[model samples]
Target: MKPSDPEFQEFAEAANLPLLRTARLLTGDWHLGQDLLQVTLTKVYLRWSQADRWDSPTGYARTVMVNTYCTWHRRRWRHELPRERLPDRAGERDTADTVATTDALARALADLPRRQRAAVVLRYYDDLSVEQAARALQCPPGTVMSLTFRALARLRQSADLHDTAVEGR
Candidate 1:
């Protein structure tokens, strides 16, 4: 059960893809997902044995990513806002469009309160049961359900705006 055990590494490897996807959903940016995954994996590596003993390694990693993000947000002044402008990319229309959509999604996600964003990612992206997400988030199941509902409502509103912009283009 020790993180150093060979079995632990195997589990970590198996969990990597889902962890990456969850990270992407949580951060709404591929680059941020990479950074989040790296941080999460490093934490997992440090405590592999203990984490391996958990019923769900994926859940543990998700929790770690969420916590790390929340901690980062707290350390930075809450008033700090993300840049509203997209980066310049010359001669790659496809790449530019993708980046724009990604940035839009990231902005939407970033606008959400941390707990609500975590709830959406855990329930929708990870497809964890309400009970499981509650356990991971250390909140009551009812609270998880409430957060999930609010998160989805907000995301739907953002999606509507995105659709309108695309249709007008």
Candidate 2:
């Protein structure tokens, strides 16, 4: 709450890695994800005083990231292409199967509409309940359920997921 609060700094430090990962998942590009994380963190910092009242401020920051990403998606230049993989090379020990499976999942996730992707990420990746995700999305819980259902259905129908075994949730 206070500008001098060290607790917010600790929260930010603890939340950064997960927030970065979530942003990457949301944007499907590392650079865009980093931008999203920066925007979200700036907003979170501005609201630092009120964040202490929330059940989990980290979760609030995630919600901000989702909102910011959605905004970016809506206004992004049409020419901006999402990358299927990060530029970083894997270590020599990494297997092809692992890389392929990861790419497939990323492609499937990337294909989703912004809202559906947000719902899927919030529900599955972030492990939020439908109600919690609904709050994050500024929608009713039923809408969150419907979005998640459709997102999962689409993911299941994706060529990669269907081509792979991908069983058991």
Best by TM-score: 2
Q: How close is candidate 2 to the true structure, as a TM-score?
A: 0.80
Candidate 1 lDDT, tens digit per residue, 1-169? 2455676678778988888888777766666777888899889777775864687777777778778865654222235457789678666445665656666766787779888998887887778899988887888999999998998789778974477468548
Q: Candidate 1 versus the native: TM-score?
A: 0.71
The true-versus-predicted C-alpha distance at residue 64 of model 2, in Å, is: 0.7
- Candidate 2 residue 163 Cα shift, in angstroms, is 3.5
Give TM per candidate.
0.71, 0.80
Measured over all alpha carbons after superposition, the RMSD of each candidate to the real structure, in angstroms, is: 5.3, 4.6
lDDT of every model, 2 decimals: 0.77, 0.84
